[model samples]
Target: MYKVIFRIKGNQGNSFKELRQAGFIPIYFRKNGKDEYYVTLFRGKDLGEVKEAILDLSYYLSKNGKYGDFNFATIYEVGNSNLGKIAGGTLGALIGYYAGGIAGLILGTLGGIFLGELADIEMGEKLVGVLGWPMSISR
Candidate 1:
């Protein structure tokens, strides 16, 4: 299995449907801030097929002027890992500890763990809010 992460300039709702039809399972679809842009994650078996589908969709959408322009920021593969949750917990713990000492440390650790687990399940949803990029995709 392969994970493909990319961002498009508009909603591209229909295009996403097409991808789903092509067997690319959407793992994440988030609007960037208040903008029309979106960052998405899809999981599929063949990377080439995934790329071709995206290119075809973009070309068709662009030719029709349906979504303005179909430009991909980048398309890259990322490993499925639990590191996000661990990192989130660590950061949360540090922040919580500094803010509230022992009690804060406990609360922060729990909050961080929750957020981290959510991030993994949502495949960079939290990271995207911070870094403006989808770092990973999960099953």
Candidate 2:
């Protein structure tokens, strides 16, 4: 179970259109330079495959700057925590409803869900650790 999101700059063409049409989930951002694409690794996709595909696309973009490299900013997140919202909510709701009924149930469920999503975050240590991919905020 893996998921990722990324942005790649490339030229506009039927290739991109075809990808989107085929459910690749590419969002085209119109630009003056090359083309920018904001894409998410759609659900149920393999992280390995996505990384390989992105690398291949990067090569293609470098070759054809017209259709690529508009703005070289790749934003991606890989991995997930299965101990997320559903678990949190269920546990919270059960406890709340037994203790405080409707009011407790509502508050507990909301808090649980919020905390669950936060707790669900996981980083790609393989990519950054082994592959040496730089993840930095300083511009």
Candidate 3:
């Protein structure tokens, strides 16, 4: 998966709608105060395709003069790891077995699994390897 982060100027709602209409789904969106917004989109497509899609959208939106200043920062290849889940489960089982017998063991295992999944997701997203910086698209 590739993660693309960019900043845009205008109503985020409409921009997001336009993006969806263009077949681009945003994974994350944030209001950077005022008319500025930060949008993060994830795609499994080729890097060139992703860039082209965004460029085309920016161009289309820019013509309206309501959406412009689409500045892209970096594109990263998202990484995945199962180590966290495995380690968490094992540790939880051990601790639970020692603390409260069978009941504790079961509860602890479930809790640990949940936490592990969260850790996996959070850490995995952050551990992304940089694919490359996308060329700035000028509208």
Which of the numbered candidates is closest to the native, going by highest TM-score? 3
Better of 1 and 2 by TM-score: 1
Could you tell which candidate, 1 or 2, scores higher by lDDT?
1
RMSD of 2: 8.9
**Candidate 3: residue pairs that collide:** none
lDDT of 2 by residue, 1-139 (tens): 3333334444445345434433445433444454444533334355565545545444444444423332343434545665678988998898889989999999889888877765664333123211212222111
Q: For each candidate, C-alpha RMSD in Å?
A: 10.0, 8.9, 6.1
Total residue pair clashes for candidate 3: 0
Report the lDDT tens digits of candidate 3 across residue range 18-45.
5665456566667755454444555555
TM-score of 2: 0.35
List TM-scores for all candidates, in order.
0.39, 0.35, 0.51
Instruction: Count the clashes in each prediction.
Output: 0, 4, 0
lDDT score at residue 32, model 1, on the 0-100 scale = 59
Off by over 4 Å in 3: 11-13, 80-122, 125-139
What's model 2's overall lDDT?
0.49
Q: How do these models rank on TM-score, best leading?
A: 3, 1, 2
